[model samples]
Target: MDPDRVPRVRDMRVRVLRATTSSRARGPLLCIGTVALIIAVILGAWVRPAPGTTDTPAAKSHALSVAWPSQGQASALVEGLGDSGDLGNKGPQEPVPIASITKVMTAYVILRDHPLRAGQRGPGITIDRTAADESFSGVESSVPVREGQRLSERQVLELMLIPSGNNIARMLARWDAGSQEAFVRKMNRAARDLGMRHTVYTGASGLEETTVSTSSDQLKLARRVMRDATFRSIVAKPSTTVPGVPGTIRNTNTLLGTAGVIGLKTGSSTPAGGALMWAATAPDGNGNDRLILGVVLHQHADTNPRQGSQAALSNSRALIEAVREWLSTITSGTG
Candidate 1:
């Protein structure tokens, strides 16, 4: 297949189905998404850091310039468990509805306040009637939970991040702080601390139109997420057994095991469209390893359920593949 002719997400929305451990678009922007994606990847290898991350030597000594989608945004940021700056970014920096990608910040706040060791289920919170009743509300995705169920923090995190349980996000928020309002306040403070000036949090879940951000801001959050061992392990899972879910609650991110995509989050809605924040490790031209974090926001998709997530993922895959190609050039001595 031609690198510049990657396919679009036309018929992949089944992957985002709301599940009891169960179910699951081809578009015209194929060429642009492919070509522009490669530019971000190659530039990702050499572009300077933005603010919080360390800088790296530019690989080819050219400025990053790519024509991205007019209706959406995309970026390939420097990836490291260590703090990184920036690599290459395309599209508008304006804050847009990010949907459930808001959960990334939710998870980050939890991890920051209550650090967890790998494999150790942190504090357990008993699921009350209110939590259970709220779990299956409205149109947002959710997992099974009983009113009286007791679950560990890891399990809640898994359900919230994997299946995008909006109720679970609130549960975590309430547990972390005393009330949802207080937790959201914490979220905004964390955003400011991280230099996410354009980012704001109206709720722990991205279901609110008020919960918004840009691709660039999300890339910053993703960089922080990749460094956390617990978050990394959970996001990489295609599926895991949750305490309340009878069937395994699988990951919504279909790209998990492919193309070095380890772990991340996916979100979609009528207003927020589809969005994704992803990370992977690939070698640059120097045969040295580089972590590449990519984000695609406001991607075009069908109105059906997670159709936006489907579209976001399809584009995300193209971007990751482009980054992989960029890395292969280094190992192949062509870089």
Candidate 2:
């Protein structure tokens, strides 16, 4: 309790505090220096090559030809077509109505879940009044099926896809899964499964605004469809008759008989404009086969049916040529 003793005690405390602070500061500096040294060692190790390093050989030689005209505008993958064509504007992602190319998906879903063997009968589907009525009198095309008539599931599928028949699509949607709503759910699910990242299905008939696809997405669908022998056969047939329809339904794909053309689908509506998804096969001089799938959307701005068809044909031809040329370059070791 003496005043002199109190001063002495405070002085000792101040000295102890300063020593503690200095030690703490020095500790941090030591830690920082240690970290810096560790980092420097790591950098030195990374920058040095191994003691036995030899010059790496040049990358395996590749044959050079003109680059495929991707132009960063049109994304193209050429496996066999020769070089020398503009694959066209890849452009910004556009949302175009796919029209009946929707059936390509419909067929894909059915084939994946329920494949049909040659000469095999599919499940029988009764023609509901709604299905028949829609098919017989829908705004778009139809394969005439009277109410109460029944057709094999395979027959309905053929009708739906071959002629892009709306009625058969509705009936098959009803028959296969009990309702078009249910079928569309499956369609969308199939799209997801197939990596159709930008696809959405609003209806079984592409007539509905709900049914939509992009050209890129459609080319994906066409690639899948081409793998199925049954689908390929049906789509390739230029004309076929369903028992109930009064007249034979001709294939709507205009390029069916065109050179190097195989089979695909054509779609058009007032809103969807004109759309076509096509596949072509060209010989690669070697034993290899060249396959090209191309999609054109909104080919015509006007609503005239004839004009729309002409636009579709012209656009499709251009796409086919581009694909063919790309394939040629790839096979020739020029692309």
Index of the highest-TM-score prediction: 1
How well is each residue in 48-109 modelled by candidate 1, as lDDT tens digits? 34443322224223232223344577767644322222445566677888888999999999
lDDT of 2 by residue, 1-335 (tens): 33435555565556555555655667877656655565555455454534322211111112322222221111222333433222323534455666777888888888787888777767777878886667656368887778888777677777887778887776667766888899999999989988888789987878775576666677667767788888887888888877777787888887887857777888777666677777778654454677766676665533754566567766667656745554544445543
Candidate with the greatest lDDT versus the true structure:
1
Off by over 4 Å in 2: 1-89, 329-335
Q: Report lDDT per candidate.
A: 0.74, 0.66
Cα lDDT for residue 162, model 2? Answer: 78
**Where is model 2 poorest over a 10-residue stretch in terms of lDDT?**
55-64
Q: Cα deviation of 157 in candidate 1 (Å)? A: 0.9
Model 1 has an lDDT value of: 0.74
Off by over 4 Å in 1: 1-70, 80-85, 301-305, 331-335
